[model samples]
Target: MLIKPVQDMLLHNADHYLIPADIVAVVQADNNLYHAFLVLTKIKYSKIPVLDNDGHFEGLISLPLITEQMLGFDHLNTEILMHMHVSDVMETHVKTVQAVSDVEATLHLMINDPFVPVVDADGIFQGIITRREFMKSFNFLTHEIGKQYDMIEKDFSSSEKTN
Candidate 1:
């Protein structure tokens, strides 16, 4: 019996997360305007949750939002710094992915919304894996089974030694 490879499906769906770093934006309340600008400059594709040291997904700082805030704040003496905390801005109750889910579920997620948050089962924030990255990684898997074989070999060799 032939098992269908999920990697094929993931690769086909890579376009869902085609967002580039050019579009990604990160912001935290602790970050100054300058720092937020730098983060925007670095990750230009999507808006990432502003994370606390404890790894909670805080507020998001996208370029468009920052620009609007900048315009609103230009005439005021109030510090833009006051708005830097992500907890004040990030969308709470972010949708997330479970690692054990199949490609069909992931595709449905991406199709419904491209910005699903990827998290561990425990709800810890892992790196956000975009639909594009997921597809790319799966495509890479399509090329060869060498890595899987190597891992299997290593496990067998270790087991033999132990025995």
Candidate 2:
């Protein structure tokens, strides 16, 4: 089997890198900020996807987004967090990539963005590709390439000695 270098491997599609939607933490658009806050607090992730009742991608919600709504003149207004919908404060202008998006394009985006949401043709959420996961995969592949090079070098040296 042949393995391509990182430069060549990046040309592949992004589907293999996805962390599927079924395992990703998500919030409903209709949920209140308080509810969103609870989930965000529980999960170690910085942000989560917001879905509509029908499982369509809506936006992204984070602690800051939810907390901003709770701010008041003198105190944190519990009312806003408990009453306002998540759709009100969640980030709608999120950067997203399709399952078949180019890995190189996705890599460029991940440089600044922490995670890129994955959506289908109809805007249905599929999964997310996080920077951490990408980095880990990159590291593993590079190491594998190094191993392959070492093996090739050993083979070349042994063959030269036999001549």
In order of listing, the candidates' clash counts read: 16, 0
lDDT of 1 by residue, 47-83 (tens): 6656555654554555655555556534732367355
- TM-scores, all candidates, are 0.53, 0.78
Cα deviation of 79, candidate 1, in Å: 5.2
Off by over 4 Å in 1: 1-34, 73-83, 100-102, 112-115, 135-163
| Cα RMSD of predicted structure 1 | 13.5
Model 1: worst 10 consecutive residues (lDDT sum): 17-26
Which residue pairs in model 2 clash with each other? none
Alpha-carbon lDDT, every model: 0.53, 0.79
Q: What is model 2's C-alpha RMSD?
A: 7.9
lDDT of 2 at 105: 64
